[model samples]
Target: MIPKYNLVLCTLLALALAACQTPWVRDAQPRAGDAAPAVAEHPTATPEPETKTTPPTPAAPEARIEPAPPPDLWTRLRAGFTLPTRLDDRRVQLHLQWFKRHPHYLSRVVERAEPYLPWILDRIEQAGVPTEIALLPIVESGFNPFAYSHGRAAGLWQFIPATGRRFGLEQNWWYDGRRDWVAATDAALAYLQANHARFDGDWLLSLAAYNAGEGNVLKAQRRNRARNRATDFWSLDLPRETEKYVPKLLALREVFTHPADYGLELPPLDPDQRLELVETGGQLDLALAAELAGLPLETLYRLNPGFNRWATPPDGPHRLVLPHGASARFSQALAELPEAQRVQWQRHRVAAGDTLIGLASQYHTTVALLQEVNQLRDHRIRQGDHLLIPTARESLERYSLSAGQRKLALQNRKRAGNRQVHVVRAGDSFWDLARRYKVGVRELAGWNSMAPTDTLRVGQKLVVWTQTPAAANPNIALQRVRYRVRQGDSLARISQRFKVSIRDLEQWNDLDRRRYLQPGQVLTLYVDVTRQAGNG
Candidate 1:
């Protein structure tokens, strides 16, 4: 039978053409008087139908778009589909066997990962990286942001510390970007893009470089050239990790796209969900902001994973991106807070020539309170010191006292709740546990009904604290002072030196009512000094 396309084309050619423009047309002519000569119009063409009824043999149906031949099993096993320049050659077959063998592991990974796909994909696209790379986290981390590899690579991308830093990821006490979806996604994409360019735009080589490094890929290229062979990632010897990286990525790509073909079921994704970033200048306390914005602390923490401390940097200009809807309320709440209140918590990184005294004076705080909040044991601080200043309406000293008293008031804060028990590990100490739970050492002991002398042991399962409603920290007691009198100092001189009256010195230090100065003599004096005394 004639093909439908041929019939449609033939029918089109036989239609009337007078209504449509042709290659040539006559110009208008005007005749004198009332007579005008007219040109003859052409007859419309019609398709001719033959009387014969014999059917024409059908041409072989156009070949279906065949899948590219699987690369030589060994080669395809080595090289797989890449994000750029290629889309069809995938390595799904190899992982199917492994997936079959480890069904439960895959299931658990899927279970844990079902929620994050949309977020991850959004970040991946934000960096202009292929969305397919999003599947890689499933293989590398089971989509756990906090996942770490034995090689010390971390985060969702499993970047090593050096690489993470190179990508602008901050590694500090409070945060690891390997777990920061936003920061890590940005850094990882930048690294991948750089590697892609460096390796001549071969994505397979770039993948190998990402798992290893560009330097290794360069060395391998040299080796292949030395041997005069095709210098590609598959032709070069690579590390074990790099060797599996490409295959695993391609296998993941297949699982994500044709999940059921591999007997896998992926959770549904909200393809349009994405986060919006709001730039918040200056360091802001995330917890405080969360409270002000009516956001849950954990939710904000999850969204702004880059903040290593409870607060953002005190230095000018910091940005926090809210998940879609949270920014408006956060911005409004932030604006409502007194400027002075925000300044009070502003963080300052000690620059050269900065001192605790200078900072205290500038912020209208006492040096002692600054040191207390910052836990500075020395009066001298070097450059690049980070200090949390209390610059708000309340002085650090007052805040400290209030916090301490507040904790004491929370004596019944902890009601019966599900308890979380943890065993101490090696290098674990009381101080560590106290800080971890944001409790004081004494309070921790009290909560567990333990004596101060109770020792912690590795592997000892002990209740750390009863779950309690969050309250301010307890007040720290200042140590009392007992002064010893020195030689060659008269009672009057001693009183002047201690900023106390001679009469009070005599009464408190128990000086003789009628004592004369003497060399090598010692007298007792009470040292009830305030922060002002140090300044004086």
Candidate 2:
């Protein structure tokens, strides 16, 4: 369809053409009312019926229009790839062989990369960088936006907290911008570009610096200089991970650039049909946003993985990514919604005897959910204070899992949610039970109405909640303090002094009440200091 301005321009052009096609008569100078050159008017043509009985069919229009084909993201990525034709080609082949041995790994990573690969390629193209850079996430995070490593690297780029913040990605209680596709991509590319320049345009060295820090790369380079050795990426002594990191990216690029050669199929995707960004002016619950957009909450979370909770941050940078074709519907629906109604909200003034648990119980939510939504570090709330409460979605399982998540979740899920009772056997400690059941010690204690430090009796039936982790109470310190029995100290006197029960002391020390106390006899007393007075 023609745009309005274009349609108007077309109309003007047609009118100009019609004016050009007008029949004209030559002007003649009239001496005295000489017969003014009369312009000949063309008469409309009417075809006379022929003697033949058959009538002719009408001709087709002068112009035939067909809809343009949608741009294919995979095709663009293939074309835009920074093809390796030098020594790196051998490295790429090496990676290809490694991939051939472990083909499923590549397939899984590719499946995970499907959502963001197109967008990453587009960003690389826009930045005029080597499209090979697009494959970096495969090595760093497998393109899993929620991917976090034990090394503390996170998101698709696998940026650690310091590096993430260095690139201006937000890290906070409610949100982490490292998981934000848009912000993280921009920051990552900017860092890549800056480092690429820092290493004097050697992308290999730059990539190494990205994997290891610039300081490490510089140290490697300095060592090479001192040894009078070649300063190429291969020659430098770098971290084991960084050494293979750049090669992995290049190898992945080769496979992606020629998927068929590697016996792999690149997933098909439309550039315009990929995920789209929607601006949220303020805090909006993802559950409500999903409902309005007709999306599963899991899908919303996948698209907006930066959100650490059920909703966006109370502060700004409020945005949500929606699947393609849903943005318009969501935007329209959102426009119609009053700001107050965007997410289900309840405003309650803190009354006497109000606690986070009590308020959460009254509102049908969890203390953790309330704390997360309101950025509360503790359950403490004052009287006459107002609290914004968010209604929680029943479960995260209601939403679909991303390709990577499904695999990991399936593996871990095998041990979770069995809901079986464990009859305590002799020598079974809470830690032992927790390790056996793959549950937390504190959770085991909570389920069985005990404590992590509590002694377990033989043949006791313990209820286990496998699906949930023990919610840690940061304010409560479960510490075992050493106490020595004085000459006058009795079990009751020791218990009174430490605010611990005599029964607990007997269990902890494995002593009978009949045993006499001796001077300087050491005993372990588990005390929750926070529950006592004069504690912070």
Candidate 3:
């Protein structure tokens, strides 16, 4: 109803007032679900700009980690060395000085011990003994498994026959467990631990006992206790060998602990580089084992010196040590091979005079074994019966490291003096033989590769090294000759033909009087040419 210009100006003023109230009403309004506020809202008010909400970022996953490998064998050994390394004692100093003077001695010993030290260290750790005990082999045998002492101690642990037997080490024609490093190590460690317990945790006394026997150590302790003296290892009146033995071990600990101080460069032995013990399943030929392991025969022999023949024992030990890489191959090959094919067999036809005893002797087997193989109820066998005999795959001579071969090599070795072969008689003794040969008993035994304590058989042959030749001696003019046995030949006939006694014939040829000689068997005879001339 107002004029046009006046109406437009009034309408603009109203619109501006409405716009100013709109924001106030919208801000004053209650949020959704909140209690209502006392405020009036403009119906056409613009809504607030829609707010954008961002999602949280996911957390990163943790990184994976790996554990480090174990340290080298020497480092592990050093870490576990719990023995007293102080060298204040004069005895320990003396040994230390000697070791320092011979630096190469440790070098050679370490070289020999490389293949065995890791295992030795592991055993010592498991037994909860001082790691220094790992070095005992160096003191005992310079790590030589084949070492045999004049005192009848043998192998790396230097166990005498009696001690070895007591420790369950079997000694037989086929095997000597004393020379087995693995078995000997376990036995030696067990022995040391037993002595340790016996000596009231005195490691020094325990080590002394290991060298000089527990009885000797106990006897020394008893004497000391009676005297009201200290029963310590240093205070005891031990044997000269044992007195130095404990100190020697301590000195070794010092050298090994601080090799740089002694100017010794220890050999690097990887902790992972090790030998693995594998089950052989049963008796196996050494040659076949070597072939299966992809190793040389000599190498196999070196690793397993316990075997004395071309094959393992007929009885069971049923285990072998092989290189870590070769163990799997050997085990797989052995498993694939048939049991019957393990050993070579021969079919023997029983003749009229063929007794099990005679056949066993001829085939170098036992009567019990012959009976078992032939499935005989007893030793009785009928003529024309076939028997399966186990024989060596290779010639006996091929096994050069065998006991017999070693003896033959020793007998044939050239020496400084004239070699004389002596044929033993029924009443012969080492003392009597040494006196007759004008040689020291030790010298006579050494020439024949025998110990003085070894028993002598009536037909056993001994080698004597004399300064004078037998031919030059007027009392006995002897000549060495080889005689081949013919069919139907007897020791009596050979003795009669050679103008030698029957006892002399058996002794020269290493024969049994009860057994008949095989045809074409060679016999070594030392003929008395002077007696022959007299008979002529």
Q: Estimate each model's TM-score.
A: 0.49, 0.62, 0.77
- After best superposition, candidate 3 residue 40: deviation in angstroms? 44
Candidate 2 matches the true fold with a TM-score of: 0.62
Least accurate 10 contiguous residues by lDDT in model 1: 470-479
lDDT of 3 at 10: 64
lDDT of 2 by residue, 4-99 (tens): 876676666656545543334112234344585665432322233686464343333334469898667766776776634443456656777988
Lowest summed lDDT across 10 adjacent residues in model 2 is found at: 21-30
Clashes of 2: 0
How accurate locally, in lDDT, is each candidate?
A: 0.58, 0.71, 0.79
Q: Residues 222-341, candidate 3, lDDT per residue (tens digit)?
A: 999999999988899999999888888889988988898777898777645589899887778888888899988877777887888778888857788888988999989998999997
Mark the regions of model 1 whose C-alpha exceeds 4 Å error after superposition. 1-94, 103-129, 172-179, 271-273, 340-536
Ranking by TM-score: 3, 2, 1
Q: What RMSD, rounded to one decimal, does every model reach?
A: 17.3, 15.4, 12.1
> What is the per-residue lDDT of model 1 for residues 266-292, given as tens digits with 9 covering 90 to 100?
544333334566766665655566676
**How well does candidate 1 score on lDDT at residue 526?**
35
Global lDDT for candidate 2? 0.71
Report how far off residue 37 is in candidate 3 (Å).
47
- Largest TM-score belongs to which candidate? 3
Q: What TM-score, to 2 decimals, does candidate 1 have?
A: 0.49
